[model samples]
Target: MNFSGLLTLQKERVPLKSIEVELEVRDHVATVVSTLNYENKKNKPLEAVFVFPLPGDAAVCHFSAKIGQTQIVAEVKEKQKAHEEYDDALSSGQQAFLLEESDQSPDIFSLSVGSLPPGESASIRLEYVTELAVQADDGLRFCLPAVLNPPFNPQYKYRGRKCKSFEVVYVPASWLSYSLSFSARVSSPRPISKVESNCSLDPLQYLNTDQTQATVKLAAGHKFDRDVELLIYYKDAHQPTAVVEGGQASAEPGTLMGDPMVMVSLYPEFPETVMSSGTSCGEFVFLMDRSGSMDCAISKSEQEETRMSSARDAVLLLLKNLPMGCYFNIYSFGSSYEHIFPKSVEYSQETMEEALKKVNQMEADLGGSGMLEPLKHIYNQPCIPNHLRQLFVFTDGEVWDTKDVIDLVKKNSDSHRCFSFGIGEGTSSAPINGMAKEGGGHAQFITRSDRMQAKVMQLLRFALHPTVTVTWDLPKEVSVTVLSPPIAILFKGQRSLIYAQLTGQSSEAAEGCVTVKYSLAGHPSENQLHFSLRPAEDTGLTVHRLGARSLFRSLEREEREHKEHEDGGVKEKLVQLSVQSGVSSSFTAFIPVNKDNGDTIQGHFLRRNIPKPCEFTGRNFKW
Candidate 1:
């Protein structure tokens, strides 16, 4: 049966109309409040399931809704318990809201608004805080995800489903009912230099004469066709800065959010030669995905180039730019993998020409997007001597078992560094980022307006150079810890972020100093960063929340690696943190109950998920 046949529709109406985003940036952390205005125009009370996207690292702090004159606040509970409660509420004619993260992809979330009376409107507000990632150009980058790229879904033999390809038709931004209104107030320790965006924006409004605070907003007329990206620059952006935040008063002491936290940012000043001279020789392996879904367009506009074509162009560029006397090879994978050569060959004019001709002839004829086997094949090969091994992956990132791939890369990290390229919009960030993080490399995203050449070249430069490894030495009374794993590689223009808890109290008169050491170009280097023990004016505990997020992620990684699922209170601790900090995690969910007494609308209520335009095809698909 077709996808629509799987769903029973009793009443139908538009679920989403407009989105309003309000963001606050203090130093390097950003807290965003997004309000989604939804209307139920159906004749009967109905439930609406809306699937949306958010940044993978976002720590969701709040979820609430307003219907009529009543406001409903959501509570954090175990995922299964929340689901059962939602079902009971809906059966008893009570309005309910359930928000959950997708099991397969952390970036995708689903929201269910149940028992909405006809002719009524529900306004949803979600608040989250996340650490801002520094870009390669010394600018802070923020992306408001708009396009929900369709992933490749395959049928298994047990399911007995057809193996036909699903198409997603692209729709222009003009088709959306309302535009997005986004505004942000930014405050930093350094002076603000400039703000840039992929979309139109109003002029910056400085809040003070020192130029440390500014406010900016998106222009009135904007086409929400693609992801909205902003690059904010500050004067002397590379300088290291430290922030100390007080813990929440309501929280218990000695807990994750109960104690004062310190956030340290270090941008290593490596010698210029360390990054420039290592380009002479290396083993470069390119893995490209040519699954059938790759045939679709990357942008909402059908006029944009297909993902397969873009991959071809990107590979061609890299092939021509490879350093002479280096080992290089290309492998294309779908259901199976095929290499242009049996083994890596020297980069020469003849090899480049042969690769280009084969690349041009490549098509999206691969049946499935399974990449594990191909990756295993690539890893099984022996590394060439006297050459640094760098593995570059280009794909739309639609694999089912993302953690498996990350685990494989992690196991082989000592042999080679990995650079992952997520092609097209709606790509899964979990895999792209996980591979790079575990493989000791960096991840890059390529969208319609993004220059593939610039991003590819950036990764090439990183591969050819050696990155410094950083370590911090703290005082005996004070211990430093990272929420994530220790630093493996430190690339130029990249920020080294550390979040730690200050357990023992230090006198206000006492000063705290940290010694950071790293080896650059086979030589040792050290730097000192000192800050006052006294707490600054209490910011909203942004650092505590971010640090907690990091700690939770680290535990998750451990659990995944060990397959303990939640051994040693790892699962329990994660839930407790989510409940106390108001952050959503894999084990917790947000469920809200509306106590408003309306007609007990109960019976087989139909379900409808707003369909998103697919990048591969312009046709719409519902999952």
Candidate 2:
């Protein structure tokens, strides 16, 4: 099966017209609303299918489509049930829309608009909320991915057929028929220092004299060729803050959405002396992707540097910067994997030279991207005694079993820290960020106009930093249960978020404290934040939904790792939370069928695929 552009049974032009995006930032959280306009120019009724990408950790809370004068909002339902409803609607000569998350990867989503009469236009609005990632320079980063290169997943089934191959068709900027318009409004408690982007933007406009709120927009006639990125900087970014959101009024009192949730942002700081004196004892393992796709140019620019070459240079820099007496190893994988040494060897001149020689000779000759085996090999190796094992992974493509890979890393998280990097455009963020979040490390993406060395060095610093532990202290009357996963990794100046369910009761004036204590280079250090129990106003259940998403992800991972015969009821729990919070999950989809008799058209429909403009470089491979 071909997983190219908007795929349809017929070979007609795409029906998608334009896309409009509106972004609203409330401090560290961002809410995005995207409207996709489509029209059926064909003579017969049309059914259009469009597959797209989203941030891996985003919580998709709203989906609806407006057909002419009527707007039909979708409801979260079980995946199978939703599909059945959609199919039933289509069979009965009715209008229906279905939005489902990919079974293999959460970042990929498929939207189906069925039974649109000829010459009719429809507008689809999708809304999602995500926490902005904190960059090394203390900027809150947000990206709107433009490329639609579906990852190569061997087990991925499209329209009930297993895909034999995956190919990315790059449509040049000049050939793009669709247009995009974007604007953003940012509000923060602290002063907004500045707003920057890779794409040209209008001058920032502050709404208030305090400089806490601002607005910006993308330049007119901007080409949708690459991912649109925004870097927002705020004064005193390291100051820890907590936002408490009230529970949904309609939800059950004891449930996830029914109870108030608290989101705590913590930034740990270590002593200057300890940070300056980095550790010299640790085990560093480097895993590089040598898939055929890595041969593509790193970006759409005029530079000739392939992803593999840039990765090699980054690896070389890492090798030369390794502290003395540290144990290290190098491994590369494509269809198969090869290691530079039989086991991890001490960092020495001769060992470094031997690894550098093989690194320079590496090529993107591997037929397909199979990373599970190499990762297993690396994890199976016994860790050296008295040394922290740090695993650094570099990849420019996606794998078939992203959840499985993440599960494996989570299972082995206690043994090592995994730092992941995505080298080029169209790289899957699910696996890149999943491994890092689960394995207690950091994830970075080197995309257009990004220097690989700089990002690599940032991660290296995080890898060599000291390991720390977190603890919280609250008022006696108000007990807390963490909804998100435990704090696994911490870096100086980078934000670490914790979500918790605040049960019991406390006075409006009651206060709570959360402390983070860690040992840096054998020296103990701590950072603390005290906050009030009063819930933040006008939060609109954002924190509750985000907390539900975090818990849902954790439960899904547990369900995957559960034994076949185990009756853990993880699936049932996931569905309950998804439905209650109105968040899309792997088991749930947004399916809405327009029951209005006037909207129904009694005619056979032809399937049309909407073509999305992708990057200038493409990757073609068969599993």
Clash pairs, model 2 backbone: 6-609
lDDT of 1 by residue, 1-623 (tens): 11210011342334566778998887778888988777777697766555566666677788888876667777778766665555555576665566776666666666665567888877778888887766656678778776422222222221122212324554545566655789998988789999998788999999999998999999988766667788888888877777778778897767778777878887654556775654557999999988666766665544358778888888888898888899999999876679999999998999889999999998776655677888899899999998878889988876645667887898899898898888776665777877876787877777663567887877776643444444555456655555656776666655667788776666766566766666666666677877766667837877787787778777766666666543656777777778888778878887764446432222222222333212232233222
Error of 1 at 488 (Å): 2.0
* lDDT, candidates in the order shown: 0.71, 0.75
Clashes of each: 9, 1
Candidate 2: C-alpha lDDT: 0.75
Worst 10 residues of 2 by lDDT: 153-162
TM-score of 1: 0.86
- 290-316: candidate 2 lDDT, tens digit per residue: 766676666655237667787788889
Position 152, candidate 2: lDDT: 26
